[model samples]
Target: METVEDVTRMHLVGGNLALDFVNTRTGPPVGPSDDDVLTGYPELVAWGAYAGVLTTSEAAALRRLSRDDPDGADATLSRALRTRDHLDEIFRPLAAGGAPSTSALARLRDDEADALGHAQLEGGSTYAWVWRADRTLARPLRPVVHAAVQLLTAGALDRVKGCGGCRFLFVDESKNRSRRWCSMDDCGTAEKMRRYVAARRVRARR
Candidate 1:
């Protein structure tokens, strides 16, 4: 379990809002542990603010509302986790040049369908979705579902890559399109050290 400090220290390295949302959990690439950063409703709001999904004031407001209605907050947290799981199932296969499961796609479509009603055209050409300012804990998921749809429709699925160390998804927006790790300072460095040690052990055996 990550401490509050660890959660607050999370960075936005996923390059896309949806991918950043998917990266709340951290661990090994295979059989990753459930080390979720958003352990509670407040943490979820904080991460939303950190990921630019919500304004700081919006996060604060949501925090207060969660305190006022703990059951609603719990429901919201469950919905957010379900969204994350669906995204992981959908995007991981797409990133690997495979198709997403029908169930996952269906869930996403349902979420998008619900979210579409809350949107409004802003400044003639721009569109924006409005979340309820009151007890609707599921409001934050609107933008996430919107972002996932945008990424899928944009036909940039080839740019999506999974980290070699932690299996977190990220967009490989490099010039050469060769990004292989979540971060150079974190997974990249650790992978290099691992390879170096393996090579030294091989030499010792020789």
Candidate 2:
């Protein structure tokens, strides 16, 4: 039942790539459901392109590579989801002023190291992570792991928030730092209607 528009509507409002990655799954803050938008390798590659982690040509190449090596593609998708879950465990607490678990940190460390191993120096001073156009199934995850590292190390952890309705993670970059919903067009409107109905019911009772 997924349409092109629905797939294209993947939330990018997290303000941070890694937080956006975690928002792929839709659910509550504590119990995010299994409704992952990246349902397959092609979807994952499309999301990578959408996230700016992969160029259009790179996404096309990855699609061809995945078609050729289904097993590798499956493994890569599994790794990507696992990485997202680890990030959820790590960042959720940090956003709440608590420390991440040692296990979660260890997983992130391993992902970061893996991502680094495939990188190459590009433009003399800037390092560009390169995954083989043919076989590097996990190439898309490198940038995501890097983004998570940046957010964790920077002073931006305090701005991370979960949407009040859907629990999607987003960075509250508002001037007042009072952002609460994942998107005003979606969860925000739904929440507003719920409150309006509740207030009307109270008035009717009175």
User: TM-score of every model?
Assistant: 0.89, 0.89
In model 1, the runs with Cα more than 4 Å from the true position are: 124-135, 202-206
lDDT of 2 by residue, 22-75 (tens): 888777666648576878888888888888888888888888889999999999
lDDT of predicted model 2 = 0.83
lDDT of each: 0.82, 0.83
Q: What is the lDDT for 171 in model 2?
A: 86
Pairs that collide in candidate 2 are: none
RMSD of 1: 2.2
| 1-206 per-residue lDDT for model 1 (tens digits) | 65556666986788787788888887777785558897888788877776777777777778888899999899889989999999989988877879899999999999898877766545557755555442356667788888898898884889998888886889999999999999999899999999999999999999
